[model samples]
Target: MFVKNGNCNFFSQKLTFNTLVVPSQPIIAPVGSDVTLPCQLDPVKDLRDMMVGWVRHDLTPGYIHIRNNHLDFLIDQNSLYLGRTSVSESRLQQGDMSLSLTRVRVSDGGKYSYFKCP
Candidate 1:
């Protein structure tokens, strides 16, 4: 699943057997504002130790944000998303993997994809 933001797009995940869920409609956010791309696992498994990643299909490398072992790692992240994206650390243990984007931009409008390691 994917949450295409009007400004800052959010990514949703995919899994085998269990599915990743998100809003049915587009997330509309005004430019320069904040947006949360809602996503979660259906069976609600802990993700605190997992690597959750958000990517934009149109870009090279495509990663806008990444959290691994409950920490954000900026290596190879796209410059357009630098210092603009985050995921809730507290919520990860409950399976919520939403990505939050700060200072939405017009160029940020697009579909996104979410991925997880294990």
Candidate 2:
């Protein structure tokens, strides 16, 4: 069997279906400036209440961010993001996983990973 989503795309033969996701392009900003990373998901099934995770690659195991509803959950083990990280979505319906980073620093220049689920 096949399934169709909001974009009217057809999936021909998969035993299980995972969420449709899109990667946000990397952003460049000057020191002390603000930066926003944009990611997206399509046909989110039922995202009325889902979980979103954002992470950054590092020397260590990396950082794991959990955002649910209107709350932000940054893994306590990672001290780099202690209190300088935040995520927001103006409209989940429109597939917005834009993460806002304030006071951008030279150390903050790196590729970040993001994931969303319903």
Candidate 3:
């Protein structure tokens, strides 16, 4: 699950059996560049029907990208990130939730959290 409380964004998940979601280490990118925030599920499972969300830690109502039911919902996404984020639809079933951020800006420098929920 993804929660936004004040200026922080929290990511959490409950496994039915034994599963893990691993996010990549801190990523650094230059301004005007692009970066991918890596995240994956250990012992992969199909995520086509799941809800995937990404948020910038310092932003409120910080939904960068939200995917569910094979569609991306961006109505609540942050204005700073509009038209600049995406996830690979074909790779969802492969457990990849990495977010591709284009034309990165200094304002985008911060921790990001990714979550996958059934």
TM-score of 1: 0.83
Q: Please report how far candidate 2 places residue 62 from its true position, in Å.
A: 2.0
40-102 in candidate 3: lDDT tens per residue? 776677788889889876898788899997999999999999999999887788877778999
Candidate 2 lDDT (Cα, whole model)?
A: 0.63
lDDT-wise, the better of 1 and 2 is: 1
lDDT of each residue in 8-105, candidate 2, tens digit only = 97868645464545444556789888766765555544332677767776725566456777666665425655666665545554656656777877
lDDT on C-alpha atoms for all candidate structures: 0.91, 0.63, 0.84
Higher-TM-score candidate of 1 and 3: 1
lDDT pick, better of 1 and 3: 1
User: Candidate 2, after superposition: displacement of residue 104 in Å?
Assistant: 0.7
Top of the candidates by TM-score: 1
In model 2, the Cα lDDT at residue 110 comes to 76
lDDT of 1 by residue, 1-118 (tens): 7788788888878645868999999999999999999999988889989999899999887999999997898888999999999999888888999999999999999999999997
